[model samples]
Target chain A: MAVLTDEQTMLRDMAREWAGNESPVGAWRKVRDAGEAAGFDAAAFGTMAEMGWTGIIIPEAQGGSDFGWLSLGLVIEELGKTMTASPLAASAAAASAILLGGSDEQKMAYLPRIASGELVATLAVDEGPRHDPANTAASVSDGKLSGTKAFVAEGDSAGLFVVAATDGLYLVEAGEGVSVSRRHAVDFRSHAEIVFDGARAAKLAEGGTGLLDAVLDRAAVLASAEMLGMAGQSFDTTLAYLKQRVQFGQVLATFQALQHRMATLFSEIELMRSAVEAGLTAIDRGGDTRAAASLAKAKANEVGHLMSRELIQLHGGIGMTDEYDAGFYLKRMRVLEQMWGNAAYHRERFARLSGF
Target chain B: MATLADPVAETAVDAFRDEVRAFLAANFPPSLKGKDNAMSAVEGPTAETPEQAAWRKAMGAKGWGVPTWPSAYGGGGLSREQAKILAEEMARAGAWNPIGGMGVMMFGPTLLEYGSEEQKLEHIPAIARGEVRWCQGYSEPNAGSDLANLQCFAEDRGDHYVVNGQKTWTSGGQWADKCFCLVRTDKNQKQGGITFLLIDMDSPGVEVKPIRMISGMSPFCETFFTDVKVPKTNRVGEEGQGWTIGKRLLQHERTNLSGGGSAFRMAGPSLADMAKHYAGVDGEGRIADAELRARIAKWEMDWRVFQLTALRVLAESKAVGGVSEVSSILKTVGTKLGQERAELIIEIRGMQGLGWEGEGYGEDELHSVRAWLFGKATTIYGGSTEVQNNVIAKRILGMLDHQ
Candidate 1:
């Protein structure tokens, strides 16, 4: 297991306090209104970097923590609870993949920059709105690349892009070979569609199917961990609302029907929590992670999606309105549900990896 | 908990296994394999014979009545792991428990935990020798689910308490020699004034009326206790401690009833075995129906998960001992899987499964149908599915119903 030591716990606690104190409830609304290209606080990012939070997943040789995936997952979970939009998860997860499968030269070239937050990168692997990496329509040739990558996360802002081509993985500059077009996701996050036409690129690794699969598994697990944080936030928000929202001469929490629903939802989240921990620990322990990652992602997709839907329904008409923050969680969950893979994809993958 | 097998303890376990296996080989008649009906040795149709009684007496005299209890208390005194190994070896040897009436399954563990020294000395020996049978009297007609509201009253009469109410759902009461019951000794408190009392089944004014179930067999009965005098010394724990004792006793009862042994020792052809037997080998030696095969594959995956979970709990309990609520979760998931597996087993049988009679269909097929019918009780008994879910809510999630 990648141990989250006392120091990591303190870092998370500080972030949680900031989320409660500094971050306003309508922070995202401010971003939407101001039309500032999506961003987080520079001072807070500096504080995190000084505390070495930015290097929480990087190797020691690259001047980072190297505590591994579980610790990084915890950071993501805490950050997600605040709905703080940042490139931490994307950068760390993508950087970990580079460390795992990229050659020594690749690591020496990019790891330090990513660790210092000087450059942010994200994995662009969704081929045609589906989660199948093998169905890549993008191809590479002679250090030049030509293909379009759909659903590029934070594409408008990211400095570097890790693109999966038919041959293997290729690294391309954000604007040189790639033309970024913004699209409004359900969560209202900055997503993009990128078209690459015979643009200059560098191939990172070739014939690294096994290594790439392992990295993809780690990415899948980290994505689930982030979703778990969203689910927790949704559950707590809905529960607090139920306790305060009075109806029929008593609080809505008093209704057995609602209590039962919340109880079932709580059980689902707890099970998902354990599943996520198990998956992360499997990667850290160097055990069979193919099955564990699929189980975690499947559980997160199913339970996270369910919790989002329930949170909205429980809040009644106020939940459907854009003015309410519950709608944001619901939207975020929808985006996360389709991020790495949805429930059905993970279930089928779990069965296949388990030798079923 | 990491448990490297102890070489010394492993030797002891293996020796005990060999002894039990040899005895079973000599004693268990060979005609009972794969017979689900024969699994319940207590309910078998074979008449009691002198040889069978002699064999039982011989086995009982060795203090192996339950094999897991302490020798000082008339038990086998083996370690918990050894006891489990003994049970497994005996099951593998095809020899049913020679002494597994209500006494061993329900009362033995409770008596070990809560019974007084004198009570243990007097009762454990006779119980170990299979000389006495015990039946539970906790569930009353008016208190099935809301058990704490039982109205069975016991009036103090100087030295003895006169129990004057009734208990329903007393399993195996018709064959039991004694009944352990709960009665209210004080009326002022809701659940605080109860007392746990043991009384002879043949006492005056005692009546047992069997309640027939859907299976056509009366596994339980309604036991009436009108003016039945139980000695004050026979009361377990304190006068007001009955509720606590009863709850703890029920935990053990549920755990033992739904433990891991049954999951591993399910009868007749397994679902996979049957699918293979009936469907025959495909072009690549696979099952024919892809959907059915996929469902079975999922079930198998879940089954392995449950087994690993069960083993984890078991190892934890062995290392640091206590009655864990984790058992309730196992019971909930395990019983659901068991019921689903039974349904799948029947579906795999197909046309020949329709034959309930006739010698054409093998004995295993008939047993499979009976097992399918019998498996329905796995969820209903040992606290119903609804009860289990509530336990999961209250105990695990800490989510009590809002007042």
Candidate 2:
């Protein structure tokens, strides 16, 4: 972990305690059983906002504490441990778009509501199966926007959409020409396919052409933080199981083969922690977010994939049962691995940014 | 205004940079620009030219060579920020620290931790001045991986210990002025039987024979002692406390050998430029060979991960002081990656990378081959990768060993 200020330390501890007490994985089981279309508990998110999590990255002028990215990542990571499902990451990302590129009118209309959790906002960037922000086909002409966005996380509940267009970003309310259809992917989160046909749009005109990529970078870092949380939980759970689970009259952890493999996983997780923290720290420092984001997401994808798989295999038979929490982590790991950008995508992106 | 939390005001930092520049301008020889100190744990000390001797004396006296060490013991005693500025200024001036050896890398810190004030006053100043060379005397012929199995005995005399044993893989032993030895003080106990003793190489019964390595370098030696008398006061800590002190020193060694700090830090041109020069690049400026390009990309990304982890571990260690189990991971992965990078360099240059001791190969080319060979010992020494895994598993991950 990076060196934490007293405030950041308190925020992290609060988030951790809250997640453990109120929104454990069992809480997600309850939400799943209820079949909520948004894939998360709304009341819980309101609780998060009341605790000042929603406005962690927002400016004080805009009704937020502007605590910064690393601080926000800490809370999101804690929530991630319980598999707490919410549009917190998406909404924060959308708020970044507004803060970076939105006009004063746009900020006044949206920032306060997003900070208060009265509004659900998200960036609608990808138009295909994979995340390719550079190939965005969304177009804004006249006072309208039109495009079909694929696999938009939290789209079903989002009240405001920051749609990426060929020229720039456009703010589209979830009414009139905007329509969202829920998609139940493997992770079973609140993902949607949205189609916009001449939606009333407000162009985010300030930060220029780089704003879309920059916002996507923020979203990528957010997703990476979530993956770090999941990876850590999976690793811890698997380790505890290894100590208890017996094989041939010895605990699995006593076997040198399993022992070394767990050691390797420990190293991998440590590396992942470093990468994710560095990404968050970069954003906080206003450094090169593009490289750091790609690096972070790439390691998160690889490590998350490795860790969830190991969590299953290390547990042997009990891991395959739906009754066990390993399957949830595994499924969520797959979905998050593909969100924003996968390992291969970010690796290539990092290479390009590094000039190969 | 410099605060206690971060005492690096721009003006103060700038002034330190200026001080460093003036020091370098006066001390560093123009001919030594871009020249680096050879790995002191490996190569024997060469005779220095007059200018080189002068430069070493100036930097050693100024204590800039070991900048973060305590100034009371011939050290610069700079803060971390000031040390960093010292490094940056040196890099900008193309000068290197002339002082480094096993003493600075491993022994000094450990001794400072566990040594008596008398020992500190005796040994540390010489190390800070780069005046004396120290070699480890831990690994014996029978105690390679299971280091505590070492059988070197220190028979108790009235005022001194008569040591009799053999130690192998004593790096720079032939050139060292002193050896920090681990000897058996009690036969009844295994780890507790060991004692940390300081032995002078010039003692009558001490002998060192250089062992030639696969890299065609005799960097390591077999050291033997036959009733060598070491003063009782030379023993560090308690007699049975040797294992603890020795292990603590190994921790220092492990951290230093973990690539970013030292041992495997390769300073030269980048691997990509070599790839482009030797293998060629495509129209898009990517490496023309697709497989090689992918492999290079993987190595590069992994290398970046290691670097980020290094930075994280540094921050973490600073926040919660002391080295972490992550340092074990750093040693394991970092050494392996350093070897991988060396392999990549060889593959990039192909035949030019395999030269022995002849013309047609540039100094850099020859150095890469030798470095690659010697780097194999990195994972083997300072606790092997397998041992590091056991540490991570048994200690960090709380995996129990089979009884």
- Could you tell me the TM-score of candidate 2? 0.93
What C-alpha lDDT, on a 0 to 100 scale, does residue B232 get in candidate 2?
97
State the lDDT of candidate 1 residue by residue for B17-133, as single tens digits: 788677667766655443323354224334545655655676677677678788887788767676677667766766555666667777888888999999999898788877787
Per-residue error at B191 for model 2, in Å? Answer: 1.2
Quality of candidate 1's docking, in CAPRI categories?
incorrect
Off by over 4 Å in 1: A1-50, A200-208, A354-356, B1-71, B76-105, B126-132, B257-331, B348-368, B389-403
**lDDT score at residue B393, model 1, on the 0-100 scale:** 59
The candidate that achieves the highest DockQ relative to the unseen native structure: 2
Give a tens-digit lDDT track for model 2, residues B279-389: 998999987877777677777888888888887777777778776557678889888888899999999999988998788999889988999998888789989989989
Which DockQ values do the candidates obtain, in the order shown? 0.19, 0.62
Question: What TM-score would every model get versus the actual structure?
Answer: 0.83, 0.93
Q: Comparing only chain A of model 1 with the true chain A, what is the TM-score?
A: 0.93
